[model samples]
Target: MTQQDAQTKPLTVDAVMARSGVQFGTSGARGEVVAMTDQVCHAYTTGFLQHLAGLGEFSPGMRVAVAGDLRPSTPRIMAACAQAVRDLGGEPVFCGFVPTPALALYAFGQGIPSLMVTGSHIPADRNGIKFYRPKGEVLKEDEAGMRGQVIATDPALFDDAGMLKAEAPLPEVTEVARSYIQRYVDHFGPQALRGLTIGVYQHSAVGRDVLVEVVEALGGKAVALGRATQFIPVDTEAIRPEDVELAKGWAAEFGFDAIISTDGDSDRPLLADHTGEWLRGDILGVLCARALRAHAVVTPVSSNTVLERSGAFAETDRTRIGSPFVIAAMNAHLAKGEQPVVGYEANGGFLLGTKLGSLEPLPTRDAVLPVLTVIVASRPGKIRDLIEELPPRVTYSDRIQNFATEKSEAIFAKLLEGDKDAQIVRLNEHFGAIAGAVTQLDLTDGIRMTTEQGVIIHLRRSGNAPELRCYSESDTVEQAKAINEQALAIVRDKLA
Candidate 1:
């Protein structure tokens, strides 16, 4: 049957997956919203929470927190989820209009599990749910188990009337944002940010005002600009050159030291230095890892090699491209009595050092800590100075191709087969000798090949968007761009 016809039929978990293309990731679950309706959210959340309840993770009297971003449909989806949690014999606590990290912090602080409704910088129409437990982020295996239950059950078995049972109003939780702001204040001192003029572009960011508050708490002038009630669909992964130029003009006009903004839920950060040049998110991740003086850094293969070369980390572990993978690796290291000083993503969210009295690092992405790292690391000089002190490694990333929703994953799978397709063989040979070793292989998330030339090329599909992402790193910025261009040429010729 056609995809539309299948979707119109009664919604099964399998049907939802097939229709919406929902997939499990390091983050709880993600998929296109066109296939994710209120019914889909209700069914999957109810099934997953019920499964959790069955496992005794939460009892009937236990409370669960719910939060979401500024996306248009977030409220509806969140409501559906909250209702589902209540129906599963849990109390639903609604933390209205908070960033995903804040909600995760609240969940850890309250000693209750939580759920966040967000699409994390995807388009306005897209939305997904992320789950957190007291221990840390939910594991990918756990999510896969939940998905299995969801798909195995009959959609018609859900009690539509029973699911609508009324429950106590969502209780107001104390503002966790204040606590996060205070953490920065306590660590960096209130005067640490003095003399820095920071311009914050508040374009439909759920954490816009909170970011401004953090800036002010640090003793910096926080200028809020481009405040938009309408969704701007800002993608933190791929920023346009024009946006960088615009930020530069704004910094010059306002005499600002830096420009910073967050993705929709304020989980992923976007930053520009004093020169108004937007740094790649992976680069920001490296800088933050360095500032934290992490002994071991956990990041995805999509990250830059400079992370290892910075001399800031004794070891670096690469994982699939997602917060869940990074967080899982960090947790494993911590279990072995090793302190996980920092965990981050090519997207700009940095997980802080996990410790007591410190919030449980949310499995979801976070933008605040990364920006704070840059600000705090400035020390005696402005952020520009820190950038100057770092090695001149440049990384370029862009999503150059689009695929039909179903075909995207298939194309990536084909690339991983590594047959002697002329284009694939040529790229394999060219980049096989760079950096240190040539490994012609497929990692979990995508096709990543390392070379002895100190360059790495990664081609993968965006979990949260409809495009394919290509990442490359080199000694010079221009050279990085050139390599990315060549890689894109190969992808086009092959995927075409």
Candidate 2:
């Protein structure tokens, strides 16, 4: 090696993240797989532990739990986390490929911190590590804390390309897959799903096997279908057209009581009715909370407004987009002594704020709970009936990827300038008019403009990936879909 090369200093965690295109989103740190080199992951983990240590979360010989999804990049990223744990004087407990909530439940039970290597439902090329506190998910405050920490690494451990020179095998770890299964079995009992023919559409999700196990354990005849070996990025928030058609065809041909599935990591749920039409996620959250008898429910502004209009809960709370924001709001409700506090995202990932019976406390998003709860709540009816019972508000969402964040923010800023009348005129000029004039504008997470005719148009940047999302709502489903489709195309062309 050259003398100057030997003297080259290693980059700090923040610097590495900045250069590698990895950054903290609403939930976790995510980036392309190439940017998530072993050294970069190690620096990220080291910074996380340092942040936790600042909060008195770790010490010498302290135990830290680790888990991963089935993504190809997961094992490598986890190995990096294990190495970091070793260097920080902490013991790493390896919990092989499991749902994010399953690992979280085990870690929170042990009163130790844990890290999950999964990108949730994003594309396979992108992945992230979700950090957990002893109590629950790390709040937004914790993300800020990690960003300020200084992380240093040994120069000898990495090559000139910044990748780990040698790979370290995972440590001896416990398998908590059964424990997570037992969690649902104990709470709902063996016959909660009796006489129900649940179709498990097993994609390449990490939780596919677990989904089948839990359903069968509950006396539900789980018919597995479409199990895939390669990872398929199934966005529960934005169900693909083909998936919708397939679920509908299967439900009609197979006579399924319901079709249950989840995203890539099985955090956010995707459920379809007996006739094969998928239900919206916010509706799932409402039904699940109702089943649990939760007096208060927390969700984000992007969720359906039917949560409030339906008058289902004693208290309803809204936050900015993301689980951290929803969980934080749920925490506030807990301080008020609200029992059975539960929260969920627009993607239908349920969070239990407090322990409910045999179910341990898991404040992280879980695809399984909402699936079971919504199915059980449908007692003598169908998933479609439970949804049809709700108010007639329909929501449609779509995104334009690779849309620069600066471009998205700039467009919103420009449209939101001047008077409201001027804004509507500009919008109508660009993409025609919404149903009616703008009556209200919500700037909670993004800019949600509600028209006098009860149409809602929400435009926001995706928290996880590089994209701009548009969510629209109307009394009719077709209009809702059309409104969003039109808006997104306009944004795409304008930005392009």
Candidate 3:
């Protein structure tokens, strides 16, 4: 059966919720396709626009650009959202089948608010909606307000027929993509990457060819490999061992400097060196910051502290682990003329310095910019050599036992109440005594604690998935592994 037919048939709210797993995350709204039907998507999009209009957030004739990734279900979701925008009395400009960064660029170019329908590297069955104000991402409070309106409003109000009647034509605007490509070229300058051969694994990414174009535009040969019809959801944060072998073989055969790829949507990047070792995302972010010699660098708390140790950034700022939080922090710094040259995530996406004058594009996390920095900075040696020259530190991340939605929320709420006496006491008693005192504790994203031995432990329920992620960092690989094991054991005891 077609998606539209399935969505039109009656389904209970409980069933929908069970299927969708709709819950709040560090980003925006996310859920499975079964739960996020055309009806639900239409309602949420309509409500968000209505909320913005009611608050005088957008002008009556203001344009609202929309885009999506290459998800099989994205086309229908995009159509529903377009209709919803029209129903709310805003012009809908459709940039069909583009990356998240592309949509952000389009919105910035049009000087209008926008939205992107994607789930990043999540499973194929999952999807999400990210809203952008003219300035940048929508705030958490604004997201909550929009969700409230969606829940309170009636879905029938945004039916297909009513939406069609309200439809208004939006001018075609593909030049925004070209403009963004040129922005990268201009920032790095022509021939910045002279004499570099880069291999791009185009495994069904929506922006696969775009990545190649950007690389070649900057004076590099891009060897495309592993082109696939089915979407390969690459978690750039965590590259599988098999993919690492494949990348190594390709790099050796092609005699390339580095291998570059992105997740399904091309928002996050994955890179492999000539030696065939997959570079971790956090390492890439730090390396890029070092290359640019950023005056002030902003990153998520989940990132490695290597940036501080590398002496590349004069000041380092940490935010909760999401692009929106990082972007917000970057915007705040720019307002004070701090001129943050770089902002990035542990997931291999880097934001360049803000562009000024004549409706400049806001610097959001992007995969292309970071990949380019890595390529330009590397010497004749493999990418791994450049990484080894840095300070010695190892970071490890793995999810603890998975939990149901209600259970995960309950655990986080308890942690936020500052009942540390009971919680900390029980944790110490369960995990045995350590050598150093609990030097610092933070609850920005989750419960993160550090020890004097240079071991760091961060525990938080995954905002996007059902798992609880526990990250550890130490001076050595073995030490990091031990800390990760101990942290997971402690979590298992507590949750049990």
If both were scored by TM-score, which would come out higher, candidate 1 or candidate 2?
Answer: 2
Q: How many residue pairs clash in each candidate?
A: 11, 0, 0
Q: How well is each residue in 1-496 modelled by candidate 1, as lDDT tens digits?
A: 2334434554455555655566654466666665565556766776577557666677787888888888887877787787667667788888888888888877887778788888877777667888877546777766665665542323342334323233324456545677766766776678877888888989889999998988999898999988998987677767766677789899788877889999888988998887778877877888887776677678887877777777777778888888778877887776776664568888778876565233444445778878877877876677778777778787788776445545667666555464545445655554443444554544667777656676767778777666778887788878778778877766666554
**RMSD of each predicted structure:** 4.2, 2.2, 4.8
TM-score of 2: 0.95
* Residue 81 miss distance in model 2 (angstroms): 1.3
Candidate 3, residue 393: lDDT:
85
TM-score, candidate 1, is 0.87
The TM-score measured for candidate 3 stands at 0.86
lDDT of 2 by residue, 38-69 (tens): 87788889988999999999887999999998
What stretches of model 3 exceed 4 Å from their correct place?
A: 1-21, 55-57, 150-154, 157-175, 356-361, 380-382, 400-402, 410-422, 432-439, 489-496
Weakest lDDT window of 10 consecutive positions for candidate 2: 1-10
The candidate scoring highest on TM-score is: 2
Per-model C-alpha lDDT, please?
0.72, 0.86, 0.72
| Candidate 3, poorest ten consecutive residues by summed lDDT | 161-170
lDDT winner between 2 and 3, please give it.
2
